[model samples]
Target: MAFSVLTINPGSTSTKLARFEGEGCVWQDVLRHTAEELAPFGTVSEQLDFRLGLVRSALAAHDGGAVRLDAVVGRGGIIDPLPGGTYRVDPVLVDRLRLGRPWDHPSNLGGVLAFSLADPLGIPAFIVDPVCVDEMAPEAKVTGLPELPKPSLLHALNVKAMVRRAAHDLGKTWNELNCVVVHLGGGVSVVAHRGGRAVDVNSANEWGPFSLDRAGGLPVGEFVRLCFSGRYSEGDIRRKLTSGGGLRAYIGTNDMLEVNRRIQAGDDEAAFYCRAMIWQIAKEVGAQAVSVGGPIDAVILTGGIAHDAGFVRLLLERVQWIAPCLVYPGEDELLALAQGALRVLRGEEPAQDYASSVLRQ
Candidate 1:
């Protein structure tokens, strides 16, 4: 029996839609939004109607109106920390997404958009392995300062998907292997997966190797002094740390291809910064190796940046000794979302309820 699932992933300037029949995607499209178009919306929640309209139009245009959908799944947003799985989008979850608790991001619109589409059809709506999935051990949460405990935020959708893929390739169940999964994208997350649970990770937004955009972990003393210097505002500092830093801060651009082009042109500075970033990634992989506390089954590299063969070759040279490196490039999040919902619809895995899974801070 085939289950038809519509997967929605709302990014900063694009809403990706995919219609899947069982494990295969029959149709997919990316709806691009310009700055002027999105400028009217004050908050992410406010764009619910706007995004929903676009999704509806896209579906209708693509003959999705004639296709019967069994389930609708969206990319999970930053909600309360919870275990990773396919989650049924309930009223409690909807309310939370509308409120945009924790923070207001474009991803918050995912669940709401999914529910709006699925509700009228009387089909189940779900979110898969959102950014807030927290499976960290108690010890891993502690830091030098008791108040500033580590947070579990990563590319959970892609990280977990790649981990499962690695297990599948190894001909082992996810619970049977310990894997270190690294998602190298605009931001990077190096996660230590032990027995299928992410026990430790460098939260992509706050810590880890500096990526194409993010600053990653920084020296606290200098950072604190800079914060107190009053040369920049809170938002400015945050933008610097999250987006304005990293390769963009060191070089002029964040595109790996452009960086490689510069390196090929004998631009020594570009090559130096690129290699330094890779070195940081290798170091973080080693740290996660200790976090798992035993022999690692594999070190998985994924996400958009992993598509660069030269970058992957350089990174593999550094971390391959820890474990056999598995490269599954590109974050195919729409497919991952569809697979999560299909697992529930097929009864292969029970769909988790959002109310019950909410982690109490």
Candidate 2:
């Protein structure tokens, strides 16, 4: 069998699978399920059974095609600061990921499923930029408690990788460019890149101003009081933080497309929330420019929201004078995953090691 790499992205209700051999795509498909279908899984691993089963069936039916991979990579969503490059999933990281049940990001399960599938098939299993590759600068990783610092989960891999490719295509380099990469999706994150590193960004909740389904950066004292006031249980607070915060917090909906439709119909509430979302995104972009200490080379907007001209227009208007704004809207995560795996396959980069023992006891 020819060596290949499979990239699986397990979303909240959708699992996207794609196979790439060398520079070309072999197979790509999305298996969608209802929320109820996933609710019974209990853990991310259990859900993997369902997701992989779906993929197996899909593979069986993919135009009579049969292909296995040399390396199986999934968009790992929980691992942190793993050298900002492709890596073989280590047992240490996997153990921590499986046991660390505090995080509830849907994409967190992507890595577990990749490992589970790869092990049975006797192929390398890995995750690309799980929880993003952007490790914030030590000074930028501050929490209210002087002693407690945390890393931010910005889409560092996708943003940086895509920008690097874009710059290269234009005969430029990332270190020579300062740009804003906007990630618009269910979970939105915009990163400011400078000198090939993500200096300052709104990757974590403590820093983000807001997002489509996130409350974003907020006043910690007020949030702590709200958490301590006995009005919300820990679970309730988590739900709000993970999936209920943003516009959904105010209007009970997270679909920006639907929100736009309602706005066209003259629903003042929808319009108001839409405007707020755009405004908040613009504000964050401004902050990113400032973080780079001004004179940003360009503002590059990409993501689901960047596809929406109206939203893009709003952002452009908000910061047109800042610098030239470029849009690469829509996600290239699958592309980045494939490219990373290919780098290893072609000997451009090293493969991730998965057999190492866990570091934390």
Candidate 3:
């Protein structure tokens, strides 16, 4: 029998749900929430019940009408650093995500929504290649300062999926190729995938280029002054770093389409900032290219921003010298989540437990 899988992906302002049968996508829907709709919640974790309600409603409204599901897979959350694999949603994993330690983001809700539905049906629930997938080499973690080390947080799910897809297109497997995949969305992540393992990646929150809605790396002196300026609280400053900064800080909006429209309407400043964003991304791709020793098989671009031809052209002009630039626009995370579950169901890959020595502190 073909395995039935439901994939749940929670974003900053939307809940994306997909149903897949075997290797094909059966149905998909996105439940978008406005800022006003989410304002009542104290944090992302607080929206669990509210979001779960929408997930159930969306599944019920499917044409099949609440058919039995063999498994449920959610985008992974901010848990302990673990290697890339499909993980069963166990109590320990859920408990940690419930009380976010390092920090909280939208992905934290993945485990909550998955278990709520899968537990009632007595089927497996899993999360694959979470943002915290730590496969950093020992040297990658060492920073010039002894007190600080770089964290391995990137778009693991989308990057891994694209690498595998690119490999398949070339009639090879992901394990046999090396590539640098850049994910450009609300945030930007440039990852160096050596063979099948992501040995190094910049935490989307801290390193890399300023994205549509994220501040990315900032000048140390000015950032520190802002933090102590007392004009903003800790939470307010963090929000500024992630949501209020970036293009929004300059242009007052995160929507690239709007920026494109402005550029068309003779907004020279908007055109300049957008081009700057592309330039920063090209530098990030170049940095990761060096991280992967030897020749780069490809420099792959995959995310919402990749769809912008003008931006892609600008980036290509800068970094195409490093390697052949490959554009696989749009994130395929839902399909990737479904396939991760299918791997375990087909006995092609074993589902990893939440606890492991490498992940332990």
- The candidate scoring highest on TM-score is 1
Q: What is the C-alpha lDDT profile of model 3 across 125-235, one tens digit per residue?
A: 999889888887888889788789787888889988899888988777888878889998899999888988888787778867998888888888898999999899999
Residue 321, model 3, lDDT: 95
Task: List candidate 1 stretches off by more than 4 Å.
Answer: none
Stretches of candidate 3 off by over 4 Å are 32-43, 63-66
**Which 10-residue span in candidate 3 carries the lowest summed lDDT?**
352-361
lDDT of 2 by residue, 1-361 (tens): 3457778887778989887776578778889899788878777756756777887787678735456568777787764454366767656666756663556666766777778777877877777765646545666667567777556677765677767766775578756887776777777677777777777778545456567778877787899999999999998997888778988888778887887888788899977777887788888888888777757777778777778888888778987787777778778787678777777777877876544321121
- List clashing residue pairs in candidate 2: 76-130, 87-352, 88-352, 89-354, 90-354, 208-217
lDDT of 1 at 327: 96
TM-score of 1: 0.98
> Alpha-carbon error at 1 in model 2, in Å?
13
| Comparing 2 and 3 on TM-score, the stronger one | 3
In model 3, what is the error at residue 62, expressed in angstroms? 1.7
TM-score of decoy 3: 0.92
Provide the overall lDDT of each model, using Cα atoms, as 2-decimal numbers: 0.92, 0.73, 0.87
Root-mean-square deviation per candidate? 1.0, 3.2, 2.2
Q: TM-score for all predictions?
A: 0.98, 0.86, 0.92
